[model samples]
Target: MTNAEANSGKKAVIFNVQRYSTEDGPGVRTTVFFKGCPLSCLWCSNPESQQAKPQMMYFSKTCVQCYACVKACPNGANKIKDDGSVWVDRSVCTNCGVCVKVCLADARSMSGKKMTVDEVFDIIQKDSLYYINSGGGVTLGGGECTTEPEFVGELLDRCYDRAIHTCIDTCGYTPWSVLEKILPKVELVLFDIKHMDTEKHKELTGVGNELILENAVKIKQMGTRMIIRLPLIPGYNDDENNIKVMGWFMESWGMDRIDILPYHRLGENKYDALGMNYSLGDLPNLAKDSISRAVKILGSYGLEVHVM
Candidate 1:
């Protein structure tokens, strides 16, 4: 939706509106989660936010097998064929969001919502006092805010006009032009650094880190406040060499603050709900000691580190 429309109460695609979140960004903040992401991080916590389009999600465990979705589907998307099993005909389904409303067990749900900018602003403004008190304001998180550059820029610009402290939690996978357009409007950026190894980066997130790394340097040069977030995945980029390389890179780039996010199984259920397999199922969370070790390694380079 256009900014005018968004401001005028026209709908824009958003997945979730999280409040009182501490980990996303500074403060007792409200996080506006936009739908759609460019990169597919295997350890993505919000699998529901990946797709740009609205889609139906199923919680098999919560389902009573009452065939409510089957009966409620207008396009016969939920049905049993000759195989004697229910199937969701994704192609025919318009995601009209009907079956989700009728589901009694909360097994059927829709991921994205179309909200206006004015609507979103109202939500964010509600916690303005809390933000002022807690050093937190509004945080824009998503599949990738840069993927919807126009919308993101306008949102930030509006927030800037209101003197709201805005932070963008991004994967840095967008074009430089897009980043350039939105970066000026934001106060702080929570840039995610997934992997240091280019090949391993591609293997995990479907793209290399070249552009991401490059953009980070450019962003640093532009003097935007930034904090680097590293997701420590076991058997992946958790090696000492990898951590050292990442530490060196951050040091060279003059990034002082780093947040090491330990991998967790919290999102495992989301993958299943989205009808996707969890790739990191067998992988265990990095031990607290390991996180401490990584912190020490980065600290040795004189970097301020926070392990979450």
Candidate 2:
């Protein structure tokens, strides 16, 4: 069932509720992936979560092109443009969700569902036993958890009241006020740092890094336990200079640990499922030695580094 149906009496937008996650935080956890994000990172792992609304996605590979969706759409909203590329006129479509229901090959799909605070709490509460055993509880990940600050803040407050260990896996791209609202309830913050260079960061992620960096420092200052996660993308931010800059920043912030997420092509397939281009497909995964080099650089600054 859609999140909306599941939370008919409440209000929030959740795209996916993933359980038994070990990598997100301190222990085994449940990750609630909120539905919207502000940045357009080229290597984003979850492109479907980018848009805030419930929208259709087409997997061309799985599509038989039988025109099932074309036939089912009542508003003539689905059509093949003059260039022979299938397109959905989002403005005309009511999101009645007719096309997705009739797709036999599972090519057409929808993302995002409206949910309520209580409905979300129910899901997180189910895993309370697991949390108690593993020292883990709930982690709010996104599309940028801060995108819907009020919902996140309320949910976080509830989790905190329940004594649940909460971690916010964020891009640090949100306003400080929003961070301030949620920081008190968060036990740990998994903040992502993509690149040190503002221009390079903008080119890669389609947003400036100034606010993100500022927010990171603010989060640290707030005394919330923080871990910086660096996605070591090859030819993007894997150079010695970038690593050194990152090390210097971590050292200055008095932050001890950082996660070196060696870049992988694992999410390339997801892009196809969403009918989006995988620009980094041709780029090979970051080499083990390259990751080691990065780790050593950070270690030189007396910072603990985990290569994940």
Candidate 3:
């Protein structure tokens, strides 16, 4: 089959298409958040990203008490409790997204939708001028973007044709074959290192780090530029050992730049909105000195670290 026939027509459930994002990669970027991730991290900020299917997200604060959803929901899933709190009756709500359309206050929304390569590319290319001026381009992120390899690869292929810089913010948990197909079109790989020890990694992220580490090596072998991203969860992986080990791993790979993504409670409310239990809900906000401390430790190890 031709490249067009091979990768086209496949649809992936994407949760968000953030425009003018400076954090996903260098310069300006359009971050595509694909839904569905194989690994479940204890402190995942994007709980809505975990599921591949379309899901509902309710913002109770945004509700104007219009009760439009109450009239539109075919399943009677929208209701006002005795205390006057309007919310989706998630128990009976099928997440068909029917009520989201009728939500007058923009309080109700769906997190995922099926999109072909062309649809997503349309959004990406609209920012082409920004990409050209800022050395920025597209970054395919997740839930776990690689879960839909064919679709993502095709998107990258299209970006390549347009001369757009392409990258992926990946957990590195998927198979090498999955990444192998897409890496060719990827200019940078933002590889995340949740924890160094395999058992500890599994304990924190619901998956071992073997595949992730191996994928790092494979990507390096392919000569793809990479920026190692480490989320510094204060009480979790901020220990000296984990930091040193991560630094050493980078040192081993002859890598220099590592981005430390500080932990935050931003996604905590998102969990409640999605009717999911956030395991780290009780964890305090990351200490003010956490990132600085990590930078000191990694810098001492001769690894360049920057806080994102």
* Per-residue lDDT of candidate 3, residues 75-129 (tens digit): 9988899987787778999998888898878988889999998899899999999
Candidate 2 weakest ten by summed lDDT: 1-10
For model 2, the superposed segments whose C-alpha errors exceed 4 Å read: 1-10, 77-96
lDDT, candidate 2, residue 113?
84
Between candidates 2 and 3, the one scoring higher on TM-score is: 3
RMSD of each: 2.8, 4.1, 2.1
Model 1, range 126-220, lDDT digits (tens) per residue? Answer: 88889889999889998776777766766776777777899999998878888888888889999999998899999999999999999999999
Task: Quote the positional error of residue 282 for candidate 1 in Å.
Answer: 1.4
Off by over 4 Å in 1: 1-11, 79-94
Candidate number with the higher lDDT (2 or 3) = 3
| Alpha carbon deviation, residue 41, candidate 1 (Å) | 1.0
lDDT of 2 by residue, 119-235 (tens): 788899898989999999899998888888777777876787778899999998988878898888889999999999999999999988999989888888889999999998899
lDDT of 2 at 216: 86
Clashing pairs in 2: 11-116
